[model samples]
Target: MIRKVVILSMLLLILILFMLTIEDININTSARDYLFENGFRETGSNNLVTAIYLDYRLYDSIYEAGILLVTVSGIIFMSKKDDDVL
Candidate 1:
């Protein structure tokens, strides 16, 4: 009974939080125009896609690379046989 009550409360909290977050989102329609006009000047990269990838989303790219490295390391560690451990 307590567990069900706790789960229901958690679900209600999550739903409330989701609703609150969703209410504040505003969509921008002129993002492409702004980017095209200023992307080269801001980033100094000739290629728009490269400028966006490297300058605009540098942290995202780094985090993705870090995740890939960790996943690969985990796979390697898990694949090792018991005899491989010193």
Candidate 2:
């Protein structure tokens, strides 16, 4: 009974906290313009989005690609395993 009461109180508290939070979503036009005008000069890429991913954020892109490769290899390995254990 005490555990239930505690959980219910926590849930109520969390809900009240969530209600009190304010989120602002605004677009920055200048950032987009700057990237569009100077992306090639800064990163040597014709595409702004590609420049951001491949040049400005190469490490993150490489890590994400590695993760994808590992996930694909893991799935293949699991799927091709023999049914000896079962």
User: Highest TM-score: which candidate?
Assistant: 1
lDDT of 2 by residue, 1-86 (tens): 99999999999999878766734435569978988888999999877889999988899999999999999888877787586422
Give the best candidate by lDDT.
1
TM-score for all models, in order of appearance: 0.59, 0.55
Compose the digit string of candidate 1's lDDT tens values, residues 1-86. Answer: 99999999999999999999989988675988888899989999989988987999898889999999999888988999988842
The parts of candidate 1 lying over 4 Å away from their true place are: 1-28
Instruction: Provide the clash count, candidate 1.
Output: 0
Error of 2 at 9 (Å): 34
